[model samples]
Target: MKNQEIAKILYEIADLLEIEGVEFKPRAYRKAAQNIESLSVDIEELYKKGQLEKIPGVGKSIAEKIKEYLETGKVRKLEELREKIPVDIESLSAVEGLGPKMIKVLYEKLGVKNLDDLERVAKQRRIRRLKGFGEKLEKKILEGIEIARQRQHRFLLGFVLPEANAIMEELKPYVEKISLAGSIRRRKETIGDVDILAVSSQPEKVMDIFTSMKRVEKVLAKGITKSSVRLHGGIQVDLRIVGKESFGSALQYFTGSKEHNIEVRKIAIKLGYKLNEYGLFKGFERIAGRDEKEVYKALGMQWIPPELRENRGEVEAALNKSLPKIVEYDEVKGDLQMHTKWSDGANTIEEMVIEAKKLGHKFIAITDHVGSLKIAGGMDEEKVMEQAKEIEKLRERFDDIYIFHGIEANIMKDGSLDVSNSLLKQVDVVLASVHSAFRMEEKDDSPRNKSDRK
Candidate 1:
């Protein structure tokens, strides 16, 4: 889908505009980018149908920008912003403590344009000399640069999943067996490359189809057993065709987090077996080469799920047969915390309810900000009563899902809730949160507090 591609450019535009100190438009661009990014359907399809404005936060101006991008593959305004500011916003933003304002300062004062430039400036002790920037922040920027370097080219799992699935669907018919392997199989939050393991006697044919796919930007290497290609979006896809006997073992080895496989190999050694990509071996005889279950069974352990194969005590748990069942994504039936347009959220209460219903949620809470947190447009007691009336009407309209009229009361400096008891009793739930003064010293729980409670 062009959704991610378009969303990325729009997000860049937002950052670029923000760097230029443009008001309101940056936020508008960002919100539009967010709405487009979350869309399940193609942005191109919406553009074709001229329904881009139907997307929340997308007005005619931003919708026109999206259309311009789709039709021309570039936005003129974004290009102009890029030429003016010329800062690598994404890389700099990846720094935990850095923001657009700081980036603007660094660019204006230190000529910091990218992570590398930021690091150089931080190391040279130039940032600390500037107003509002300290030695500590400079040190933090250096550390952040290291982190950004590590995360440089990794794609979000959500972005790469569709492409990987599409490839599998295309190549499934050409192989005896096939499964996603590597970090993709383990479902890492960020992925470096796509790895697919398949068993096929006709490896040549499989490799041909895999490398020749429409998404392939360049064929890095192509062989009978293995092939690697760079996708148009810069993600690498590696296809490997192994023997049917070694498919499971290959799958297990390839789906490793390195540390997980290392521990599993140690278990194999302890049990007088050798484990590798080919199979689990016993004195050179293949003991478990057919399936993952048998391979783990041979190791005297339960088979580990791909997600849990991160070497985080999973091996021990599997060996002890004490692996806890992890909750699947679809197992969630309700979302307890949410905000509507009544507060800072982009969507309305009814819109949230409709989306939640589509996602199979049995219940949802509309926990809008309330009380003295005016920064978030927090509702007062009177406004809460008004929202309650609206929710009651909604609850009647949507009978399938339970709607909870909730309030996110701010926790004041003294650690007491900003909401009143009378108002609290009126809502289904009270989500008391620290909305301000995050770095304040914690108040001691002295006997005085207990005495006040008494």
Candidate 2:
């Protein structure tokens, strides 16, 4: 579980390097950090096997650094970089529209080393007098700073899910049934904290194990029915143990949007029944609770998926028995976007194809980066043509899946693609995306915009 701990240090190193105006190395560090963070295997185990270099985007030097940290619990280079920069760059850089280059400029010009410093300078109207900043940009920076301050404690769903799943897996043996609830279950883009509910006859044992998890940095509370702990990454998690008969009702009550719960409660009242975490009751008799479907059946509605319980007409849909079917992972046939060593990806084309086939995919597209995105080592027309030939040869070896040659073309400032139209037309798939001009507020009236508008 040192994966996240190592990733955090790598990200901090990337920020320090960016602040120092070092080019290329920051992107490499960040890519390695991302791959490591997403790894399913324990990093400590990988280090033990001396296989850290086998990780995609990780090279000899980076692997050595990982080993150094694993062995000694410190990284010399990162500490030196931290001493040189000497600021909380990650927090400052998190503000919307604030990139490393702009951060460097602010730091050198106005001594803006953190959010507070930046906010103070913006309020004083000193930022507008800088070379490229204006009154409008200054106003936007202040707004972004305020938003960042408000959301500072929240973590991305993608970042926190792995830790949550790990904790649940460890607790599985002690509970009859367990499920994640709260924002994590609702699939929110950002989560304030984690909530877990379990059906267990042994609440005391479960609570003890929950509060003493390996990742727990602090045990906030430990009680008979519920326990709360803060993880190493500052994510607070609460675990509740309930009777098996009431598990479904408890899950529905906890996995909620406030608005959705209010609407459901109104429905319960209308039906002459009372509903709570314990169970659904009709005339003081417990009617349903063992399953979520039963609870919904008692309310004269279809069971709703957790993702759709946001008070966005889901209640009405359930009443009409017309809730949409949510797509499951098994329903996916292929992946449209992927990369290989031809661009910035960690694996080779053949390696990626083999893995895709193992995943039961019927098809895959290798959409590597192309043209002028120097940090990604984007391919030019000649290199892309070379890659196409290589992919053609590799196609001869695979019979189970259809492999498409693709490119993620960079959209230039003038609304033209980085790759020529002739080359683009030859590919099976093309992905056009914006990588710069993040601060531009005005919408383009170009043909691309017109088509999208229509």
In model 1, the clashing pairs are: none
Q: What is the C-alpha RMSD of each candidate to the true structure, in Å?
A: 3.8, 3.7
Clashes of each: 0, 0
**Candidate 1 weakest lDDT stretch, 10 residues:** 439-448
Q: Stretches of candidate 1 above 4 Å error? A: 150-156, 201-224, 227-237, 344-348, 351-361, 371-377, 412-414, 434-454
Give the best candidate by lDDT.
1
Candidate 1 per-residue lDDT, tens place, 1-454, comes to 6787778888999888887788988888887887888787888898889899999888888888888977787889988988999988888899978999999999999898998888788888999999999998888888888888788789999999998999999998988899999999999999999999999878899999999997787999999888999987679999998888898899999999899999999999999999999999989899997798889999999999999999999999998999999888678898999998898776789999999998889999999999787867899999999999999999999999999989999887666788889998999988989877765544644335645653
Return the lDDT, model 1, position 433: 91
- Candidate 2, residues 1-454, lDDT tens digits: the string is 8888889888989988987889989989998998998787899899889899988889999999999987887999998987776677778877888888888889889988889999999999999999988998899899999788878889999888888898999999998999999989999999999999998878899998898877898999999988899987679999998888888888899999888988998999999989999999998898998887889888999999999999999999999999999988778889999988798787789988988888888999999999989778788888888998988998898977889999999887667788888988889999999987665546664566755653
At residue 372, give the lDDT of candidate 1. Answer: 80
Please, what is the whole-model Cα lDDT of each candidate in the order they appear? 0.89, 0.88
Which residue pairs show collisions in model 2? none
